[model samples]
Target: MAALTTDSAKTDPLIRITDLTFIYPGSVKPVLRQLNLDFHQGERVGIMAPNGSGKTTLFYLLMGLLKPDSGTIEIFGKPVRSEKEFENIRKRIGMLFQDSDDQLFSPTVLEDVAFGPLNLGKKPAEAKLIARDTLNQLGLEGFENRVTHKLSGGEKRLVSLATVLAMEPEVLLLDEPSNGLDEETKTRLITHLSDLDLSYMIISHDHDFLYELAQSNYTMKNGQLEPMERMHIHYHSHPHTSHRH
Candidate 1:
């Protein structure tokens, strides 16, 4: 299949894949077949597909959380082939997991948010500064000493996101970011994301949210990802509930 690509994807790829393929353990069929994609700098891409279509698998592969069966993944012109290489690549990219609880563990929100920077070799004071700045950026300025487990779902989501942002990555991968947020919190999340000037991809089941944020969209099917257009807004608010594939 011809992969859909943006103009910048062809001219200046920040994340490039060539003939990517993968199969899960204990599975007979390959989940991805010669798949190709190019995520460019400063692009806001939304990836969507039906359930169990390997959307999350693709994100995991890009982050080197899982190794591909075949093909090359290049970031910033360097091909990732080893753990050391991926470690370097990860410093430039931050991935937010689907579960907020999985990312937040420290007793206090500030400590949890500072974890990434601390792990990256920053001093405690420096890491705290980054964490505070990140939280402030996300409209959580006074949440520094709050108990992490006591926050609402939306607060947890924002705090988890702040953890990733504190790393100061050039690229962000947000998966199911709006999962547990209420409409008001979701709107706040959207506004915060809109103001972040960076290259990123959001994987979501929420079509309406994706439509508002993504400049380009794609859907995965039959082990391939291809371009898709946003369905007209009127179709959603009404009962139709259909979308482009």
Candidate 2:
């Protein structure tokens, strides 16, 4: 299938994948086949697919965690083919892992959130301040010194997001962000993400969440992305009537 381009493709995209193909070692078939995508700045894109459809693999390829067997990947208008090139890309694009436990490792919430900024060369004090502000932005102001492992699932998810936001990334790649959240927590997450200005691409199975957050939606089929219409829900009011006996 031909890859679909966004309407704003005339402008340079933040990330571009052209004819990308990948195959696992010793596998008889390619997991991804001639995939093409263009992600522009300030766009909220959602991707939905069944398990083992190469959705997460696509994300890994974008971040240079996995190399493509064929085709090219360009970020910020430059071709990326090496880890050294991907280092800068990683700084600009933050990824929120599907599992919060895989993301947070520091003993304290502040430390986990500040780790990215520190690696980016910010002073310890400055990194802490960034962490605090990120937490505050997420309505987690008092969680600075909380024990990382002791936090609830929702809190950990928010803190994991805080760790990514602390680096001030231009784009975010969120994997199943609403996976384990309660309805209330999911609502909170939706509100918080709606208020952010950054561009993001979310991979999720929750159509409701995607409809709420994504401006553009796509479905992954046979290792390719095809544009899809957003799902909409309508409401109706019913009136009760008394029956005479």
Candidate 3:
């Protein structure tokens, strides 16, 4: 896929990517090609695309999981030019991966949620307090000692988000948050996400979830990002519509 660029508003943008391109270690071609986009603070942006449309790749780039070949990625007005800069920016960005199993691998749910803060040098007790509070906020009170591996699919997904929330990141990156959730759980997830104050970028195939949680939309096709039209229907009406713009 060839890379492309689009113009962003002249106002201050929270993220800036200029001519970014990246190819996997052993792959012959780059997954993202000269991609450029700017996201503003406090915006709930939905990234919609078919499978392998570079949606996940874009998230990885923003999260510092993967480095770009020859472009600049700036976060919060700071340029990410090296691993150290990326590490610093990572502390301000929370991420929920596509697979719950990939994220929740600790012995207990509390341990998993505390991992981020612990790595940042907080005391064990303080980290536990943060984790417990986050879980309580998500209606998972009194489940701190629960074993992570024993959780159900939906439970694991919620636990994953709880872990990220404990970090109190300024930017939230969620990939396929509704993948394995039941209808009730999905509704609760939407409610929780809508109440968060952080800026967020989400990659999802479920249009209903996007409509309820996202104020703006973008799509990736052949390694390029195209801005999608803003949708303005009452999302609470049908609760299951997948209509796109």
What is every candidate's alpha-carbon RMSD to the true fold?
4.0, 5.5, 5.0
The clash count of every prediction, one per candidate, is 0, 0, 1
lDDT of 3 by residue, 1-245 (tens): 12222334445678988888888889877778889888888888898888977889888888787878889888887778777888888888988999999999899999999999999899999999999999999999977999999998888999999999998899899999999799889988998998888899989988788888988888886677888876532334445456443
In candidate 3, where is summed lDDT lowest over 10 consecutive residues?
1-10
| lDDT score for residue 127 of model 3 | 97
With candidate 2 superimposed using the best TM-score fit, by how many Å does residue 26's alpha carbon deviate from the native? 2.1
- The CA lDDT of each predicted structure is 0.88, 0.91, 0.86
Give lDDT for model 1: 0.88
Highest lDDT model number: 2
Model 3 Cα shift for residue 241 (angstroms): 10
RMSD of 1: 4.0
Off by over 4 Å in 2: 1-10, 232-245
lDDT of model 2 at position 90: 95
| Ranking 1 against 2 by lDDT, winner | 2
C-alpha positional error of residue 197 in candidate 3 after TM-score superposition, expressed in Å: 0.7
lDDT of 1 by residue, 122-201 (tens): 99999999999999899999999999999999999999989999999999999989887898899898898889888999
* lDDT digits (tens) for residues 1-245 of candidate 2: 12334445557899989999999889978889999998888999999888999999999999999999999999999999999999999999999999999999999999999999999999999999999999999999899999999999999999999999999999999999999999889989999999999999999988668878999988888888988865421111334363211
